[model samples]
Target: MINQTGKFIVIEGLEGAGKSSAIALVNDLIEQHTGQAPVCTREPGGTPLAEKIRDLVKIADASDPLSDEAECLLIYAARTQLISNVIKPALAKGQWVLGDRHNLSSLAYQGGGRGLMPLVKAVSDACLAGFTPDLTLYLDIDPKLGLTRAKSRGQLDRIEQQAIDFFERARQTYLQLAQQDDSIIVIDASQSLELVHQAIRSQLLHRLPLLFANK
Candidate 1:
């Protein structure tokens, strides 16, 4: 049964689309209203074991012998752990949980971006067993601009260093997913950080007026 007092909000987007920053802003907003800090986390890591998998994926060198299928499966394994250990328990306790990335990241990044849709869906369906987020905030940004910001940063991780074309494909896939799901809100992230935060706030309020109104 769904909990009456909590909400699950997932923030998704390309690498440089400002997902981390937006999550901070939204958490603050939610706490202001709800009087409790939301549970914030990210995947491929939410538990101790899941975090190990995250490190393997992010820091693995090209010379490592991990196959595409293996990589995808590991991600799902971590996701399964995350849901069992963190998300479900938080909701059971009536605490909102805001995730930096969720299952959609796999659908867009590995499936759409890397052409592994079948693999992504199979793992998601088998392990997830039909769990879904209440709302997904897709921070949309052009690949060129997003990559520019990413490159300006220090050493790039495995997914971060993927070809620019990969991100383009990922962004397009995100849009397609958003179109199909009314719960997904795509916010143009090319604007200033403040503006983007405002947009997120407005969108969240519009979607869950009762929750925001009572807070």
Candidate 2:
């Protein structure tokens, strides 16, 4: 339902929520339907400076630990860089942008998990008051199962190494936000990958029929 020629689509979820596969599916669908490959981007990355910021955010250092507020600021700093340098340009060029993670991740992780919603909100408002994704696919999953799956992937990052309770709060916040916003579609990630893809496709076709109507 977005009026812009280029749309911003974001995928959000906790670690091991199968976001990688979801991104692939979304990319394929966008290309197939539009005959144009969407520009893919990931928050805290996509640009050189942003990638460096991503490393800083992910790596754990006992000697110089990152405080909750500092972590939140770092995430926004990286996001601002990505948006200014990559996302905005691609969108202005009439290219659909598929984002691996967007602002929602911060709202969940920094706000809910870290219990710093007020500061997160202030930063978000200052940086991106009017910006929003055209569509957000949120893969919902149990934190314990998500952590187990994440662990199976190899070494965990600093945020991923957090206790289960942290992810639980994040999940709760995701659900609450999804309930309030029609633009966000929640998918049960516990199901098979095929089922999750089906849900995503179904939601896309139903919610944004105009995008694929001619195709």
The best candidate by lDDT is: 2
Q: What is the lDDT of residue 100 in candidate 1?
A: 89
Residue 194, model 2: lDDT of: 88
Q: Kindly list the per-residue Cα lDDT of model 1 for residues 112-191, writing each as its tens digit.
A: 98899998998899999999988899999999898887778777787887788988888889999999998899999999
lDDT of 2 at 46: 84
Write down the lDDT of every candidate, Cα atoms only: 0.87, 0.89
lDDT of 2 by residue, 1-215 (tens): 22347788999999999999999999988877667888999977889998998898999999999888888998899999989988899888878899999999999999999999999899999999779898899999999988889999999999998988999999999999999998899999999988999999888777656643422
The alpha-carbon lDDT assigned to residue 61 of candidate 1 equals 73
Best by TM-score: 2
TM-score for each predicted model, relative to the true structure: 0.93, 0.95
lDDT for 5 in candidate 2 is 70
| Model 1: lDDT of residue 48 | 97
